[model samples]
Target: MRPDLLLHRWSSSSVVILLGFAELNFPFISSLHIHVELLRGFCSDNPRNQQYPSARIKALERKMQKLGEFKLPHFFNYPPYFTLQPVRDTREKQIQLWKELILDYCKSQKTFVIAIEEEFPLFTNHVIERSLTHEAKETFLSALVSEGRAEWMDKGHRRCLILWHRIQDWADILIQFAKDNGLEDGVVTIEEIRSGPESQGTELHGIDRTILNRALKLLEQKGKLVVFKGTSTDDEGVKFSI
Candidate 1:
């Protein structure tokens, strides 16, 4: 066999092996294959030395642009990150990072809830065509729940309330809101506090009603405020003593 032909055959076989490893979800091998695939054209003797076709380049650019203002971390594209790790230490670290990322993403986007069955941007990496499995999503969110950073909205765990700001934090924010709006010694309706002009443009605006009620209850317990139930739910009012 010719030396050049043998080299070509060996290279082709190596590529196949790398792709096989990638298909098996080996992160390091998959990453290596991706790099090789991206640079193969540049390494070849093509006159243009173009790394990829124009259409592919444009597609990549569009994917990046679609990410918008929320900058995803580099690890998001790592396929294994989407899977639930079995090792205790590794899984703990993964869960911790996922919790922080979920909180940060929800805070940035002002997203208050995450439906497990729904398509969450943070749960999918389009660039790598990877997504968190149902079990993996539940595991990470459960970790957050254990830490009081999130809550299961239903007994089935299909819906999650992401408390980027904890109940205590929200209560503090409520106190500040009262002071800011000169309602520290006055009364305001529950609905008004949620969507009124004073609440608009603040973090309290558009807060999930469940979370808002929890915060209000906490404040009520502290004797900082008194919640009065009205004939109509929307007319329920709070009197601030602070």
Candidate 2:
């Protein structure tokens, strides 16, 4: 049998194979089930064969290790996912995946802020040598902002404030924390609610002051809390009404 026909016959094998042929019109095999060493030997003598897949696989493995606790979906390893898909349905799914991955990464890392020009781990894949462009970054962030899961920090759009929990949800959490600590109708400094002993180890601890203020304002509008600024700007306080 001719080598081309033999290759076509072996293409259905489960093993991954990278074959390079000089003839562009040849009916080449898309996959192979043969041993990798055998395939390597077949291509070893061919000067035109390009070794691309192994390096790509190695890079992907490195990226997986860098993910830490963030679990990447299977499609994340697919190279096409790094580009903006042109098809409507495929692009929709791609955008959705980007949104989910961004939110998950932020929540896992406790990342409340994302600066556009800054180096963010989630925005780059060192393994695939792929990274989201500025437009792609804005598209994903804007989707989250539309859903109230994030906000633009400034008019220049250089930064974003990620809210894994909506402002209303944070308000509810704050109220629950106050009630649990017997602070209902009691006063606490804004700073205390953020880093005081009472807030330590709780979801309220280390909360962003801007987010906290927004949550408090939401509650205040609903008569659930009162925010009063002391004479000193640093002495702002909140009084919960249960």
Candidate 3:
């Protein structure tokens, strides 16, 4: 058989095998299991194997270690990972995975920003020479936008602000900081958090000014914090109540 034909045959059989698992009616676990088995089959069937199933499983296992919920391992050198589907159920799962992966990658790397044309390490697989096309990247990120977990950084989505940690998380961080640092009843300049030595090297270090402001505003709406201005936008301070 031609190498291409052999691979194609293997892929088709794997899909059938995956569907067999998916067809099992065992509730939540069935879907999860199906996804896992599908990944297993996909990895195992690769002709490049020197160690067969063990090597494939180990490779995927390592890839998945870096990802969080709904996120798959970085090993999706396969082309299917990039395509957004019209199939309702599959699309939902794929979207969920993309959201989780994007968030995980951003949070761990402290990537607060994502650009459409830029090469996101999360979106590329040099091991297989595959990268997300612009449309695919937008599709995944737009899913986040719809769910209130992401936003476009501009009129065009060429630039995006990824809220992997979310505004609520940012608010929680502020609340915790307030409680920990005895700022609950006191006030300090926003610049102090954004640039002062106090926040340096912490998660707050070098945070984008806009994200900091948004997080503060979220806290303000809850009446847990108040923002007051003194000299400039950078000099704004917050007073937290309890």
Candidate 4:
């Protein structure tokens, strides 16, 4: 018999042999038969040997490890995902996903701001050589802004302030902080609420001054607290009533 034909005949007979063993109830034979079927299916489905390079695969794995517990969605690797979809429904869904991802990533990294033109790790997939275009970035960030999850820092919309926790949420947190630290009726400097020892280790620590001001203003509107201007902006004080 010709070599090719002989090999083909053997391949056919091998399945039969495995099936016979499986039917005989041999230990492990059934699993072996299943694996053989899976291997055959894989070979048939990927006849072109389409597979990512080993080095690229390893590089992606390392990059994921560096993300440090922030798990990216599987679709993040899809090439088309990097491009803004033209279809209305598709674009909406894509924008929603991007908004969620941006919020989640910023929260995980404690990232308070994102410059549209700057290099944000979440905006790029080095493994696939894909990154969001400036327009796409703005689109996604705009969606976030509409939902009150983020704010544009400049009139040009070049910079965005991420609010994983909304102003109301931050106000609630501030109230809790006051209750915890017994500052409900006491005066506290703005700096103290930001970097004071009492605020250390809390979400208030190292908060963006802009966001801090916004949160304080919301509390002021509700009469929950009164902000007192001092000699300098950093010298501002707050007197909590609740």
State every prediction's TM-score relative to the real structure: 0.78, 0.75, 0.67, 0.76
Give the Å error, residue 42, model 3. Answer: 16
Report the Cα lDDT for residue 77, model 3: 37
TM for candidate 2 is: 0.75
lDDT string for model 2 (32-61, tens) is: 122234344334343344343455434444
List runs of model 3 lying over 4 Å from the truth.
1-75, 200-202
Clashes of each: 0, 1, 0, 0
Tens digits of lDDT, candidate 3, 1-242: 77534444555435533443343222143343334455454444555532336665566445644433334543243445556656777667766767887887787777888989987777875433457788889899999999888899888889988887778888888788778778879887888887777776677766777788899998888898899987878777878886
All candidates: CA RMSD in angstroms?
A: 5.7, 7.3, 6.3, 10.9
Predicted structure 3: lDDT:
0.68
Candidate 1 off by > 4 Å: 1-54, 61-66
- RMSD over all Cα atoms, model 3: 6.3
By descending lDDT, how would the candidates be arranged? Answer: 1, 4, 2, 3
C-alpha local distance difference test of each model:
0.77, 0.70, 0.68, 0.75
Which candidate number maximizes lDDT? 1
Query: Which model is ahead, 1 or 2, in terms of TM-score?
Result: 1
Number of clashing pairs, model 3?
0
Best TM-score goes to which candidate? 1
Candidate 1 lDDT, 99-214, residue by residue in tens: 88899899988899999999999888776567999999999999889989999999999999999999999999999999998988999999998899999999988888999999
